[model samples]
Target: MTVANRFLSIDLEKCQGCLSCMMACSLAHEGESNLSRSRIQVFQNPFGRVPDDLKIHYCMQCEEPACMEACPAGVIYADTEKGNVKRIHTEECIGCMACITACPYSAMIWDLENQHPLKCDLCADTPYWNQDRPACVEICPMKAIEVRSEE
Candidate 1:
């Protein structure tokens, strides 16, 4: 699987799992500080090594998005205007979870409240954080996550 260079990259060694990135993501996109609403996540693995102990989940902005291909309702589309960010048309989604299941990086998250899948859109239309990059990148305390050079 040769994916194009992703919009976001991570350095595991720098992450401490404080979850500031997740909080910022949720606040920016969902307007609340709820971990469940966050598009990016940090999972702690007790059995892993120092850096490998933390796992970050975020949209890669794939050139060929698996989520888009797996959508039965054809609601997931790429926003060419915003660096081809993969987004879901919530109104048209069928809540089938195919996109969530097909995502290679597990980037598509289930919106428990909306009954739909959610993927990172780089805060293209967010009202909370009026920044050039995604909120997560800016809020990362350890600077573990960063916008990829190609973007």
Candidate 2:
């Protein structure tokens, strides 16, 4: 089968509120502990009844990402090789809040101490391909996620 650049998409229909994705996301991104540092967040709808309320939230990595355009520091860049991967050049960032504010999905967050933005790179810098999928996709006990090319 031919492969295309893509990300692991979580099926909200199957998520059980286990938060394994959040844990994995934090571990991979921060290289340390702290839930606030995690790029992916799970929220339960206060108004929804029972199971439908729970869902995992993260970047959709939109076809045209606002975060990339909003960064005044020019830290965010689309991966020329993979297209699907977006990267932030940490060294170039000036800790400006433009990108975080531009993200409609709230996928971006401020890294206070570092004074930089912290968000999901979808584990792109890691050795995820040789393994199964990203750590979040692999560790999801409910098997609620899958990686695929755009249709």
Candidate 3:
């Protein structure tokens, strides 16, 4: 069956860099508020002249994902039912760090403790807190992030 592909769309202009999304993401995935483990990250543009130069970074879930191709262990695969969302099977991951190097956007985050790389999976296609949305999108106070579905 064909399923609509979902992607997280960010409005940079609306982002306040409060990092509420990152905190929420860590809480949901790690059962604690640890930004280091968050799949989503916020970076401040150091060379920018303006103080509001911040960027929210996360997986794009590309049509052709480099991470999936770079995984020698075949841990990363696309979820066809969830609109081809790219996901990493942690159990099968070999922690080769290939996905981290292959990502052009540097969206993949390394887990120092687990020795595995992490990326956004749109909350693993599960309902968060009874809501059918990602924790980051739901907790954003500025509403800077949104999930868009492509048919």
Candidate 4:
């Protein structure tokens, strides 16, 4: 299968435990400022610092995606037309949470309101689709997030 040439990269050292990335993601995608609607999440440690202080739940967009393999309805697919991004066809979804559980990175976000799973499509089909980069990358004040490509 064709993995995306462009994918996300994160520099945890530059992260300041800010929720900007999350807010931007939610707003751009769902037209809301809800953190739960955000595809990216910033998890901070209660008893640690720096590296341990953050566990970002942003999709790594793996070369061998477990979520794609686990989808029974075949709703999650690598969209070749959309930069080979792994995307979910919400209309075809069977409301199974297998993809969510299969993601080792915990990046497969479950949309509570929609009763479906949500993953980053590299901003290929978001409300802010015209931008050069994803909302998280563009709105990141610390530049903690970025998009990298094989090319």
lDDT of each: 0.80, 0.73, 0.84, 0.83
Q: What is the per-residue lDDT of model 4 for residues 45-147, given as tens digits with 9 covering 90 to 100?
A: 8888877688888777777799999989988877777666788898788997999999999998889899899888778777555535889888999988888
Better of 3 and 4 by TM-score: 4
lDDT for each residue of candidate 3 in 1-151, tens digit (9 for 90 to 100): 5567778898888887788999999888888899999999998877773336886679998878898898899999888766677899987888889999999888999989888888998887445733247999999998888888777
TM-score of 4: 0.91
lDDT (10s digit) by residue, model 1, range 1-151: 3232437787888988888988998898888899988888789988877676877888888877888898889998876666666778899999999999999998878989999888788777886334346788888888877776353
Task: List ranges where model 1 is wrong by over 4 Å.
Answer: 1-6, 47-49, 128-131, 149-151
TM-score of each: 0.88, 0.83, 0.90, 0.91
For model 2, residues 10-55, the per-residue Cα lDDT tens digits are 7778887777777887787667656777777888887885468976
Off by over 4 Å in 2: 1-5, 45-50, 129-132
What is candidate 1's TM-score against the reference? Answer: 0.88
- What value of lDDT does candidate 2 attain over all alpha carbons? 0.73
The full ranking of all candidates by lDDT, starting with the best, is 3, 4, 1, 2
**Which residue pairs in model 4 clash with each other?**
none
The Cα error of candidate 4 at residue 115, in Å, is 0.6
RMSD each, Å: 3.5, 2.9, 2.2, 2.0
lDDT of 1 at 6: 36
Ranking by TM-score: 4, 3, 1, 2
Q: Better model by TM-score, 2 or 3? A: 3
